[model samples]
Target: MNLELVTVLVLALIFVLATARSVNLGVLALVAAFGVGAAAGLSTDEVFAGFPVDLFVALTGLTFLFGFAQRNGTIDLLLRAGLRLVRGRVALAPWIFFALTGALMSVGAIFAIAVVAPLAVPFARRYRIDQLMMGMMVVHGGMAGAFSPLSVYGLFVNSFLAGDDLGGSRLGLFLASFVFNTAIALVVFLTMGGRFLLGRTEDLAGAPASEAEAPGQTSGQASAQTSAQTSAQTSGIDLYQGVTLLGLAVMAVGTAAFGLDIGVLSLSAAAVLALMRPDDARVCLANVSWSTVVLVGGVLTYIAVLEAAGTVEWASGGIAALGVPLVAALLLCYLAGIVSALASSIGTIGVALAIAAPMLESGELGAVGFVAALSISATVVDVSPFSTNGALVLANVDAEHRDDFYRRMLVYAGLVVGLAPLAAWTFSLLPV
Candidate 1:
């Protein structure tokens, strides 16, 4: 068999092994990268060069920065503030969490899920809200803002399009995702019994305020400080947490307004926080999702080899020969949505864009709209049980009926995978 065919077959095998054996797909992909790189007649150095250094820096920096926030009780502070903003309106509780998480993702996608899912799931359980509703809303909110101009997804799409000399609208993609996710959230709110929460605010605050302390901390300190902190929180934000919130604001505005390098600014802000709270260093560092970092590094490294070997071009060429741009677009959308529902949404988006670029350049379809359809469809299905955001929710639930929640999420996510691509495509067909 030819080199291209061999590498493609290996790709299929990696997915099968990961699914069947519950192994880290990244590890398998890294091994395949070496074998495929060698089979393609590339030198060792060239293979290593395919490593995605920039993405590594981006994911690590954001996770590291947010890790500090998580440990320092800053995220807890935000949750308290959001709950207060809802003012006992349980019906609005999920929306509050949704908007806040969406705003975070507008700044950065990967870090948003890591930070928000932990908080939202617990909140859902506390109020007897549907875990699937709350969890999936958080996922949708993350994807909603994920395509904003300052976000990684938007940056990736824009850069990819620019490289192809295509004129794509950054705002268009953002709007498409925002609208699509909002519609989904609305449906969830109405059908999932959100209306039942109205005027029913008792017992919501009956649960004692719980603190999100760094690992290795004591309940003694938390108990002693809980009343005072709760009182202070009622009137105003805690001093240290307020400062951390300010720092987060700067991270957002600095990157979005001033066009600062997000990775650099995140690391700098986290470093400052770290210096101020040296005792929290170990816990913060421990919380950064190293597995995700490794997954991204490995998967993209393998993808780089595919790019180097002209496999992406070969795929696009075949898609182009189909003679129907819309049909090709739909197929690619379904492919991206299906794979992303199971694996890395970011990876799937990158690969999908590579395949769609040829059809996009043919001018038979609207470049901006098609890109929006591709990206939103690729990410919105992160509600699937197999995806990180979905799994995060399932993990955070109280152990009671955990499997039942998982099954519910599975059913909901399956529905999204089946229907979301069509909605995303319809939204993209609009002029916006």
Candidate 2:
């Protein structure tokens, strides 16, 4: 059998074994990557080279920093401040998070999500919001602004087109992504218990102390009372929290404005906080999502092996051989969506656009619309649990709910992989 086919089958087997046996998927993936890499005649160094070290640091650092914040009661303070800004309207919380993340991603998607997910997940827990819904909103919000002129995605697409002399509309691409993601967020809101949040308000301050201590409360009420008590205690920021907040601001500014590496910056900030409070550091370090870090690392490592084995090129070559421009365009959209769900969306965009250049030059497809559709198709699937954005959200979820949330995200990603390409193709490409 061809190396490409062998690698693909190994990947499928890994997924099946992990799911059925309830083993850590990342562990299985690492084993598979080694076996497959050896079978494909890769050296040990080449095999290990695929390990996502940057992602590992980012996940560990972000989780640790935020976990420290939660331990010091800073998260509670921020939550209260957020509630005050929104006038305690619980329903508006998701949208507020969406807008905040979107605005941040207008600078860069990776950095924006890294900054947002840690805070957003804890906020959802505190407010009793749907975790999946909140997570998806944060991801979709990042995609919504990812194609703006100032963003990395937007600059990459535009520069690639200009360099290759493949004509496309910069404005159209940005607007399409923004509008499409916004619409998807609305659907998530309506279907994912968002309506229940309407007309619900929580006291910006803790619930009245007398009411919280009153007897005969249901379990739900008791949970709320406990949460309120915690919030009340942490309402005021102390010295440690002030320093942590400063570190966060510096990390944000350094990453967004100065184009510093987010993983390195986050780790630096986390290290500083850890040094100041060794006790809190021990507890927060225990809270880091090491399982998620392993899972993402192993999957992406195997994906790199697949790329090395020529699986991606093999698939794209087959699509290019179809000879029918429109059908090929649609298939390319699906290919981008599927591969990107498991891999880097930006890398997928470069591949798809490079492959589509011939068709665009022949005037068989509209450059602007096709590029826009393809861009959106590639990115909107970042909600997949395997992707960096989705993995960040999963890593930040409370430990008790992490497993169920991973399953839900996987299912949601499947739905998106099935439909988002078609929808994007219809709306952006078909009309043109």
Candidate 3:
């Protein structure tokens, strides 16, 4: 087999082994990256060149900030505030999470999950809410806003298309993502138990667990009692949490408005928060998603190796040969959704553009619609268990529930992988 083909098959086998057994996928990918790169006649540094250092720092910092906020009772306070906004309706928290995360992403951050997931997952557990439903909403919400004029994903795709002379409507890109993600969010709401939440207010946030709620309860019910105790104990915010919130705001505004680097700003904020409660600094560090870092770092490094080995280009060439415009549009969306789910959301946008530029240049497909298809397809699948957003959700859950949450994320991501690309393509072609 060609080196590209061999590397591609090895990547598939890594996924298979990771799934069939109880092992960290990141570990497998790192081993696979080394083995494959060496087999393909590359050196160690070339293989390691794919490690994403910026992503590593940003994930660590955001988790630190979030963990500090949680440790100091800020998260409980905010969850209470969000509950109040919905008049104590538990179902509405998902929408709140969705909107909040979407707003953050629209402001230019691609890793809105790093900000929202830490907050949403715990909030979902606190209220007897469906974890998959809530987490998926947050991920989709981030996707909904990720193509805005200021968003990292938006700027990259737009610049890529423009550079290739494939003209498109910027407004169209944003609208397509908004409409498609909204539709998907609606599907999640109605199908994933959202209807049960409608007009029902029986479940109060932070209520003490009843005798019927088992200690070994595997999902949402398990977290409620613990969350309730935390909320019940917390009173008004103190000076430390107040400063922590301020630090969070600084990171948000600095990165969104001033175009400050996320890692730097987040680390600066985390440092201030750390100083406020030095005792909790260790706690904050402990909560950082080390597994998530390893997973992203390893998978992306291997993806870089694939690029070096010509696997990516070879695959793109195959997709380009398909003759039908609409069929090709759907497949491109699928390609975007699948790869983006498994790898880097931001990087996949570039890959999608590169893969589709040939089709766009042929003039059979509309450039604006095609970009929209590729844009939403690549972004909305961030709920994958291996993806940064989904891993953040998994990482933030109560430790006892991590295994179960990971499985749920995989199932939900699988469903999105099967359906979202078609939805994105359909929306991209819709008038206006």
Candidate 4:
């Protein structure tokens, strides 16, 4: 095998193993991608060219949009609404968080973590809730969005499988399953996880008057407090108008007006939104997680080289040689999901789908099963100890609530692992 191809395969395995170890697989993958390209004697431009520019743009734009939502009390409003809906039921908090996260993701792909992070601390502190539960909710919420059509995960997966006979590549169909998974998971969290883990009175002590006193005032008080903090430190913008206009504009213009890719539109919107407020530009930029950008930029180069060198092709052939294409594909996805939990979902999904694309295209794996595996495989990174969502929970959790966070993660992971495979198995047994 060529040195470049060997390097790509080795990096991919490292990426998967790193997920189990809770390292930043994206950063590592990014570095490896560049190194392999350089080792192959590819130019800097060529090495970097494979990076997904459009997705990065979308990710940045989504970050800014989330910043806008958090600042203008849009997310606060939603959070307040969630508190009211739950009505002091601690067990229901996880599902409430999950639903809210899903709703935000449905609108903007990458905004869930940014939107949910700050809230997790206060909510956990207020309710004396489990930090892990909060983390699970945040991770799952963002991931649910990532897997949605609005997210780059779906876009990248689709782009790789584009024009192929794979049934799993359909945007609407994939999203339908994504939504169902979230919904089912949300319900399970509320009913199964909620009854046992939630409803502790001590948890609601963070906002004494908020949840227990009048209940209606919970949302109002929380909203007021959040707005004050955000506005005091920074000037307020018309968050509702800004987000609504920007989100709608991007979707409409990208799809209708400019005929541009959603990622491009998303990225452009971020730049445009930043330009809207000169004074807030610093804050907005600061709010954008550039580490993630750097991580993604590097991986783009890596995956591109993987394609150029036929590393993924050869690996697919190796799997075929095992004479268990479906099982191999499913296992690959499982490994991908776990790895994704560490790096973030997009990179894991990017590499996994990249490797599997050839096999799916070759009819080594059935279409329905392929999509099922893709959907299931895309979410493992959501709850990893090093995941962005995991970071949010870890940072937000007080000492008292630490155990709660882990407990919920254990519950969430177990369910996610179990449910995803069930979905894939059902797909495998289907008529197709």
Per-model lDDT: 0.75, 0.75, 0.72, 0.60
Between prediction 2 and prediction 3, the one with superior TM-score is: 3
lDDT of 3 by residue, 163-251 (tens): 56888877788878887888889888888888898877744444421211432455576555556566445567778878887887887
In terms of TM-score, how similar is model 1 to the real structure?
Answer: 0.87
Error of 2 at 70 (Å): 3.2
Better of 1 and 3 by TM-score: 1
Question: In model 3, where do residues sit more than 4 Å from their true spots?
Answer: 39-41, 88-94, 100-179, 187-234, 335-418, 427-432
Say which candidate scores most in TM-score.
1
For model 4, how does the per-residue alpha-carbon lDDT over 1-432 read when each residue is reduced to its tens digit? 677458766775766666667555566777776777777777778877777677677667766666655555556555655666666667666666677777676655455765575566456555545445456666666656555555545555555555234556445435544564576556645654355664454333234222221222355666566455553424433554456456645674565455566656655665565666655657877877566666666565677777766676876677677787767766776776656555656666667766777767777666655665565556634565456666666665555555676666666666666556545444543334
Return the TM-score for each candidate structure. Answer: 0.87, 0.64, 0.68, 0.75
Q: Rank the candidates by TM-score, best first.
A: 1, 4, 3, 2
Cα RMSD for predicted model 2: 7.3
Q: Per-residue lDDT of 302-376 in model 2, one digit per residue for the tens?
A: 766766777756755676678776788888899889977876576567657766776776677888788988999
For model 2 the TM-score comes to 0.64
User: Which of 1 and 2 is the better model by TM-score?
Assistant: 1
